[model samples]
Target: MTATILLTPAVEERAPCTLPPRLVLAPGETTPVLIDGAWWPRSRDLTAELPALIEILDPLWGRITRVTVNPTFWPVIPRKVPVRGHVVHVGWFEAEQDPHKLLLLSYTVGRWDLLVIPPETEPAIAARLMATATDPSRSLTATGLIHEAERFRITAEEAVGSDSLREAVWDSEGGNDARRPASHASAGAVIDHVPSPAEGR
Candidate 1:
């Protein structure tokens, strides 16, 4: 009997593609808000990241002419970045701009402020922060939203730790430890007292 051997082809590694910007905008209202929306970027590289953001916002908010960021968060800031066929000017400020916020200026639309969620944030925590930041009813600023996110993350970790400890205790004794009451902590407690938007300014 003759056995046939088949050679397997090696799969080629592909370059990583950019993800769509994780952005959420607040409901439009007559009154201006401290923050217009929130953007969660995948990296700190402003040059590499700005094009995708501009492409998404250009049509909805008008042609974005200028964008500004704080030097603290972004490592390298290019003077100008080309998006589509036009050039978008990039500016950086230390004292004037908030580290957690990005300011965008458009040709048709006036100015827009967005909460810049950190690149390394957990998905759950980032989602909560994005929702809160864009909430029209909430007067929290970009900084305030970040503070709230941190608090929420810490609380959630504590809750998980507590749950594990309880499970360990139950395991040590019998599985049917009916006498012990179940304890649950709420993560929403931190979001209840969001600071006024003015605090961030």
Candidate 2:
């Protein structure tokens, strides 16, 4: 019997993600910033990540808008760095109920969301969120993040302009839809180098 040799196909390396110009930070910056519903990854901690992030999103959060982070941000190591604005009155929603995990910023500039999706599924879920933030007409029941989102939410008072976002995952009934089950008990955002009150502005 003669045996035939088979060639194996080499796996191609994924290209570097081309982030939007605005999303690109200076020499050093932390990332995985959930911008306009898209996620941008960075390789380092930034000197002024928040200001730079807000600057890129100026059209949405504006220069002087009051931005509040969930209390979960405080009480962490490094002794509680300060933010541009104060913390919200009501505490954060349980992980089983928060709308977004990257950041729970409360801004009054306006509800703004933009999405540019590639062929990947995770990005598409993020894009769908951005799309839903600005437009309530779109339903997110079909989006990939709904199952995870169903278990995380903010308070009624802190959930301004997020009614649609809260409802998008209602269909999940707090259970997995199709993807692998997600870990839900991780701590909230840990944005390093966020300028202290005196250091910033």
Candidate 3:
């Protein structure tokens, strides 16, 4: 009897990636902000955590694209921290019934910062919204959001804080800044929405 020769095909081993996967998610209200990787755990409860988030988040309620209270992962985001003061609130204000611009107001124990994001549709309106958010005389309730389908909506039960709360990230350092100021500024404006090269696999 002649025995046939058998050969086993070699399995190619995958190389370990040196760089971490870039975080990506289209801006919108949703669960588990990070798309391709692990950030928030599957075992945690969002309902039990909602109240504390609002208490800590205080006045930062608006069109929140993403939020997580007491997240359990090292977020891959470039953020200025409490050293400058954490971002306390983020949302987009309305402009002549259209989504205008993003108004982000950050605060600390004794400090506050106001940074504006464009496609500035109505610079005057954006300035007013910013003023409303930053005005020391205004109450948190007075700065409440307008309900629009195009914008992210936060119900009375869902307001929350931003530490470990990631609503947006960048493909590069200039992702938000590199775009032309004239680009349309919707509630969820993603000027840089392409997936990372690592995600191609």
Q: Which candidate achieves the best TM-score against the true structure?
A: 1
Cα RMSD, each candidate: 14.6, 24.3, 25.0
**TM-score quality measure for candidate 3:** 0.18
Model 1 lDDT, residue 197, Cα: 33
Candidate 3, residue 85: how far the Cα is off, in Å: 17
| True-vs-predicted CA distance for residue 129, candidate 3, Å | 1.0
Alpha-carbon deviation at 103 in model 2, angstroms? 8.4
**For residues 1-201, what per-residue lDDT tens digits would candidate 3 score against the true structure?**
111221221111222222332111222333322121111112122222222332333444332223312122111211111111222221222332122112223233222222211222244443344444343343332114222211332321133322112234341333456673533334234434534435534
Candidate 2 vs candidate 3: the lDDT winner is 2
TM-scores, in order shown? 0.76, 0.28, 0.18
lDDT of 3: 0.26
Error of 3 at 58 (Å): 22
Poorly placed runs, candidate 3 (over 4 Å): 1-76, 79-119, 141-201
Off by over 4 Å in 1: 1-17, 176-201
Worst 10 residues of 2 by lDDT: 3-12
Per-residue lDDT for 8-88 in model 2, tens only? 211112122234332321111323222335323232111122333444555445533333222232221111122234211
Tens-place lDDT digits, model 1, residues 122-143? 9999889888887767788788
